[model samples]
Target chain A: MRNLSSRLSRWLISGPPLLYLLIFFAAPTLIMVFAAFRIPGDYGGLLPLLQTDDAGKTEVLINAGNWHDFITFENFGRFFEDSIYAELFLKSFWYAGITTLICIVLAYPLAWLIARSNKKTRDLLVLLVILPFWSNFLIRVYAWMIILGPQSYFSVALNHLLALVGIEPVSLLFSQFAVIIGLVYVHLPFMVLPLYANLEKHDMALLDAAQDLGANAWQRFWRITWPLSLPGVWAGTALVFIPALGMFAIPDLLGGTNSIMIGNLIKQQFLDSRDWPFGSVLSIMLTLSVLLMAAIAGWAGRSKKERA
Target chain B: MALLEIRDVVKTFGDFTAVNHVSLSVEAGEFFTLLGPSGCGKTTLLRMLAGFEQPNAGQILLDGKDMSQVPPEKRPVHTVFQSYALFPHMTVAQNIAFPLQMAGVAKADIPARVDEVLEDVRLQQFAKRLPHELSGGQRQRVAIARALVNRPRLLLLDEPLSALDAKLREEMQLELINLQKEVGITFVYVTHDQGEALALSHRIAVMNKGEVAQLDAPETIYSYPKNRFVADFIGQCNLLDAKVAEVGGSRMKLEIPGVGLCEALPVEGAQVGQSGTLTLRPEKIRLAAAVTHDADEVHFKGKVHDCLYLGDVTIYIVELENGTLVETMLPNSAPGRARFFDDNDAVELAWRFDAGHFLLG
Candidate 1:
């Protein structure tokens, strides 16, 4: 009897949080799946269709055609056949890849400097890096829009400078370059923070020991410092790459209508077109891409551990 | 000519001085140790010699060259840190071969040199293991091999055996002594352990605060310390406050309160009525059943307070008449013959006139 009460108490303690997740998160996802196949009625809610037996007795009915009627492959077939969608997907991948590379190159020296600097200087630099996040992310991205807009302060200044060299004013606003720049600026802190956290804990004596053994500056860094800090590099790469892939606001505001990424397509399907089924399919595909990237990262980590 | 010379070297961190105006010259192929307690600046002085730290006001000459401006990496000297500072990512052989590889030595020569150093340090079989995989003694050997592989003119060790257990520390001390003998390189070792310093070093420089208290051979430093600090630091010594009563040829009569006048060696420039301390080693004071010898000048009657029976010797803590405690070591013989002195047993303490040295301060 006592054992039963203990088991009941344990169940009661854990039941509320699990039930909350199931109702608020899991239930909505399940309902979305069900609603994707439901037949449309006069209103948005699905209504039951009636059927009569051979005796002609009236009875409440459930229609199986609600699940089977929408057999048209129009959405999936269109997404695959259209070259625009394919191009957008490929462009998103390349943009995220380039942003990740730039973040790695830039954040490495920044993180190293922060890790090796004196305490007061390091704290000040870290504060400056994170100060942008104090305001709303959307507001920060919008600030970039003002800087790159035509006839804006930067554009006017650059145009005057170029006119002196007998050149035309460069159009940088609403371009893919603007979107890439916005992504790099917004995600740089994410890359630097993790890299600094890992690099700060490195044993600096290892470098000194290497130098004592006749290793010059370059040899010491390549053979000792870099290999010891590989984990931080991998962590920084993942932190920058994953979020840049799904970035929506920066591309929309900076790239304007020309830069339509996968995130923009998903947003348009759900809100603009009101096609929840296709939106759900696209959402699932984006999630799968993230999962695949995570799996590859995990594999790389495992191999590194094995080699060590 | 000396292999290393540090002339009037002083290091200051802001207003606080770490190494004062100190000067010393070390001969080639000599094992010299800097012996001091923590914060005494022995390590700081060693670092200056290694070119890791530059003195604020001094000059360091290495092999007749002024090396005060040279950096640690460009210098021909290496240091073995107390932590071993072994590269965690490199194997034992690779760790030792790093210096040679950095010098752009031939790839074929690197392996053989590594093997030679490993064999010299008796760690040839564990060449492929990482530092963390080896025992503390083995890791220490690897660190030594790594430093010696570079063929440096001078090797500096900063309390290298401080991180080991007692047994391992002893074994490593002997090994280090032998290694120094074999290599014939100038060794500047830093440690706080007096026994380690005495055993391994040809000469020792005892440091106090930011200055060298005394620098001499091991026996001279132990037998004839220059001051109260050296006398108290080197070994257990009884320091009695006294004043000079009379001065003779090489001896002086000191009048100690609560104890009668005693004869002690007259230190240089000591005069009558000068305040000083009479320093006597514990082993130098003899305990007997009665005053058997007429030549014994300073004698005291005391009662034994405690007795400890060690394997080879027994120590008796005798409480003198003036309520001061004195310890005397007696060798153990066949059972009761050596056990005559016990707690509360009365005994007489006496020493020769030359056993006690007078310290001015």
Candidate 2:
């Protein structure tokens, strides 16, 4: 009886935060899933409908058919049949992969240079890398749009230069390339920081020993330095890839209609089309894909640890 | 001709000089040691020899060729770092074969050379283990095997045994000596342990303040140290301040105030009426129960301040009339031989005239 009282007291002390999470976070998500399967009116409003059973009595319905039309898998089939949705999904994956690869290539040398530099220079470089992150991310992405858009300062200057060269002015705004550039700009620091943290902890004595053992510069890097920094590489790539996969703001602002990604499609279904069922299905798929990627990355990390 | 010659090497980092105009020559196939305290430039000099660091002004000649501009990868030298610095990503066999692979040796021949070196270091069973899986001594052997597989003209060791415990360090030292003899490669070892240097080195160069104070055989360095620093650094010695009262062809008379006069051998630059310090080894001084024969030459009366009974020897800290404390060692010949001395026991200290070395400025 005494232990039970103490346990009850402990739970009472910790109950407020748990209650807050349940009311604010968990209840809203469950309500969203509940709303996703409700019957739709002509204007796509969720309204309860009546059903007549064998007893000749009318009853208000909240069944599977009212939610998702008797679980026919129609939402998934519709997603696959639509070329636009399929293309957007593929484009999102491709863009994220490209961004990750580019980030890795550009960040490795910068991180290596920072790690090898003297103390004062290393501090300056780190400050420069982190200075952009201090500003609001939306403000930073918007700044890129202004710089790269036509009639902006850079585009106007380029137009003048092209005129002098007897060439026609080119459109540099609302392109897929613009969105990729913005993604890379925002995520480059994420990649460089982790790589720098790992590379800085490396023992320089190993490099000298390798050279003394007759390894040239390239051989030393390939055989010793690169393999040792794999953990950082994996982490930095994941940091850039996961968020870039779901990015909507940059693609919506910088990309034209033809370059829309899966995130923009999901946004359209929810707000523009007011179709909650299809939107939920798309959200679930995207979340599952991301979770799958995370699981794979985690497995790889564990295997590397075991090998080490 | 010398296998390696350092001609007036001077290295400075900004304003701090690490090696101050040092010069030495090492013959081929010799085990030479540079012994000193930390920050004494022993490792710096060794690094310069290996071409890791270039001297501000000097020439390093190896095998009749100048190696001042030669990169470390191109030089015919290797180093076993104190940390072992083994490649963490590679197995033992792969590490031993790395240099051979880098040199573009045939793939078949590389394995044979790797096996040969692995056998030499007695690490054949550990050929497939990574560096992290091996013990400290085994990692050290792998480092040696890796360096030896390249067949470098010289091998440099920078306090390689310092990371190990006492017993493992002793074992590694003997192994290193045996390996050097078998490989017939010149070894330039750097260590601060006087005992290790004396044991493993054919000749030792004792360094102090970025300069070589004395370089000679172990016996000569221990007995005939050129300066007070070398005398104090090598072993325990009782240094006494004395004035040269009289000088002769082979011997001199020194006046040690409060301890009476003493006859000592004159160093090379002794002069009359000059104040100098005399060095006497602890083992050379003997303790007598009473005044004995030949006591007038060199003897002093003192009281035992403290006594330490080590397993092999009993150490006596004797206090003289001048309040100077002297430490002397007595061998324990029999089981009860050390029981005679106690704290505050009256004792007589005596040594021969030749045992005292007068240090001249």
Candidate 3:
């Protein structure tokens, strides 16, 4: 009786969260997945395949034929054959990969500086990294537009400087490079926070011991600091890459017509072409790819811990 | 020439002085200890020798070369840190081979060298295990082996055995002594535990507030401390305020207010009527039922205030007439356990004339 009561109490504590997830997240996800398989009606709704007659009235109902049609891979086939989805997928991955690499290159030294700084300077740097989040993200993207635009202060000053050097004025706004810069700027904090957390917890005495054991600065970093900080690097890379993969606003605001990423393609399928089934298929594929990335990262972290 | 010469080294952290004008010379194969309490700057001095922290005012010469401009990696010294700072990602053998690999030894010879070090520390069976997988004592052994593998001329150990339990600490202290003898390398050891310093070191420099209070062998430090701090720090000592009644060469008679006259070996700067402290070790005093008149021994009459039986020794707190307390330790060498004197028992204590050391400062 006591054991049963204890188990009952434990379930009581955990029951609400489980029910909330089922209602809010799992239910909606199930509906979207079911919709992905079904045939679309005239206005992006599921087709009613059942009919009923009661008294003198006839009513539409779910049909078994619609369920059979829903199970077929026709929408998936149309998505792959009609659209340049493979190219978009590769380009999205390429952009995200480059952005993640750049974030790491920039974030590592920044995190190290903050981690090794005195109390006041460390707090200031950390605050600077987080301060961008207080402002609206869309506004921040617009600010980048002004800074990179042709008639802006930066372009004006650069054109003047170029005239002195006998070079032509250049355009930087509405390019792939601009999108990358926007992505790196917005997602930099995500990479810096995790890396700083890991680096801050490191014992400085280890470095001294390594140096005392005849490792110079370069060897000390490669042998001791780099290997030890790998978990942080991997974590930061994942944090930046996952969001950068399907980012829409940055590419829409800064990228030109040639720079349409996978996210814009998905958005257009749903809103522009009203192809709900194709959009759902694309969404499912992206979700699966993200899950794969997470699984790989988890495996890498686990093996590293086991080896340690 | 000494293997290591520290000449008037001074280290200041901002406004506070950590090591102030410290100077010493360590012989090539001597196990010299810098013994003091925490914040006394012994570790700071050791760090200066290791070239981790530079002294602002002086130079550290290793093998007659000034090490002020040298980085830690360039210096021929290794340190066993207090935390045992073993690389968590590396196995025992890999950690031991780190120094050798950095020194550019041939890759083929690294394994054999690591094996030799593992054998020396008796961790050969567990060389493949990571640092976290080993016990505390095992980790400490790996740390020692890692340093010794370098075969540096000087090894600096900063309170290496402090993390171990009492029994393990005692065991490791003896092991370290033996290891030092076998390797025949100068070890600049730093610790706050006076007993550990006395047991393991060939010479101890007892530091007090960034200054060396006394530097001598363990026996001399115990029997003849140079000042009140050295006397009080090393072991349990009873210090009585006294005025020098008469001084003749090295011996002097002191008039202690509560205990009356006591004979002590006054330091060289002792003068007549000079106010000083007389230090008497607890174990040197003997207790008896009645006063046994001996020409060489000074006797005192007191009543026992407390008696503590600690298996191998019994400590008695004896109170003099003016309520001054004196502690006397009697070893329990007898086969059977018995209490010698109970509370409030009248007793007489006696010690040799030369047993007390009179500190002028």
Which candidate should be chosen as best, given DockQ against the real structure? 3
Point to the candidate with the largest lDDT.
3
Q: How well is each residue in A1-308 modelled by candidate 2, as lDDT tens digits?
A: 99999999999999999999999988977766655555345475445467788999998665765644433356667777878776777889899989999999999999999999999999999999999979999999888888998969899999999999999997776888888888898899989999999999999999999998888999999988998898889889889998888888888888877777878877877788877667766776687788898898799878966774
Per-residue error (Å), model 1, residue B265: 4.9
Question: iRMS value of model 3?
Answer: 0.6
lDDT of 3 by residue, B145-223 (tens): 9999979999999999999999999999999999999989899999999999999999999998998889999999999
lDDT of 1 by residue, B1-361 (tens): 8999889999998888999999999999999999999999998998788776789998899998999777777888888988999988789998998888887889999999999999989999998898999999999999999999878999989899999999999999999999999988889999999999999999999999889999999998998999999989988888878888898686778888777788887777777889988888888888877966565468888889999888777888888777877778777776756576878988898888888788985
Please write out the lDDT profile of model 1 over residues A115-168, one tens digit for every residue: 999999999999998999899999888888888888688999999899999999
Which of the two, 1 or 3, has more TM-score? Answer: 3
Model 1 residue runs over 4 Å out of place are: A1-87, A116-127, A216-220, A256-258, A273-285, A294-308, B243-258, B261-275, B294-298, B305-315, B322-324, B331-344
Model 1 lDDT, full chain set = 0.84
Q: Could you arrange the candidates by TM-score from highest to lowest? A: 3, 2, 1
DockQ of each two-chain model? 0.54, 0.69, 0.79
Better-scoring candidate (lDDT), 1 or 3 = 3
State the displacement of the C-alpha of residue B317, model 3, in Å, after optimal TM-score superposition.
Answer: 1.8
Q: How many residue pairs clash in each candidate?
A: 0, 1, 4
